[model samples]
Target: MKIFVDRDKCQNHGLCAISAPASFQLDTDGELQYQESFDDEHIDDIEDAIDSCPLQAILLHPDAA
Candidate 1:
């Protein structure tokens, strides 16, 4: 799957990082960073991260056709 975050909508709250530590994190500068792609095994965690976004900034897409 693919993960995308809207920088304009996100506030760097780190909820995604908390929900999916294996896939997302806040850099030392406090900027949000994450895997653009992820394994299927991480789907649940990634979905949790998506749901955790208060701004609804996180989006999930299937692998490109």
Candidate 2:
């Protein structure tokens, strides 16, 4: 899957990071950063991250296509 975050909407709350540490993180500048693509095995964690984002900045795409 592919993950996308609306940088403009993200408040750097780190909820996604807390929900999916392996896929999401906060940069040194306290900005949200994440993997664009990851193994399907992580779908559950990714979903959790998406759901846990208070700002609703996270978007999950089944495929880049």
Q: Pick the candidate with the highest TM-score.
A: 1
Whole-model lDDT for model 1 versus the true structure?
A: 0.92
In model 2, the clashing pairs are none
RMSD (Å) per prediction: 0.9, 1.1
Tens digit of per-residue lDDT, candidate 2, span 3-44: 989988999999899989989999999988899988888889
Per-model TM-score versus the true fold? 0.92, 0.89
- Deviation in Å, model 1, residue 40 alpha carbon: 0.5
lDDT of each: 0.92, 0.90
lDDT of 2 at 16: 90
Error of 1 at 41 (Å): 0.6
TM-score (C-alpha) between model 1 and the true structure: 0.92
The count of backbone overlaps in candidate 1 is: 0
Residue 29, model 2: lDDT of 95
The regions of model 2 sitting more than 4 angstroms off are none
Clashes of each: 0, 0
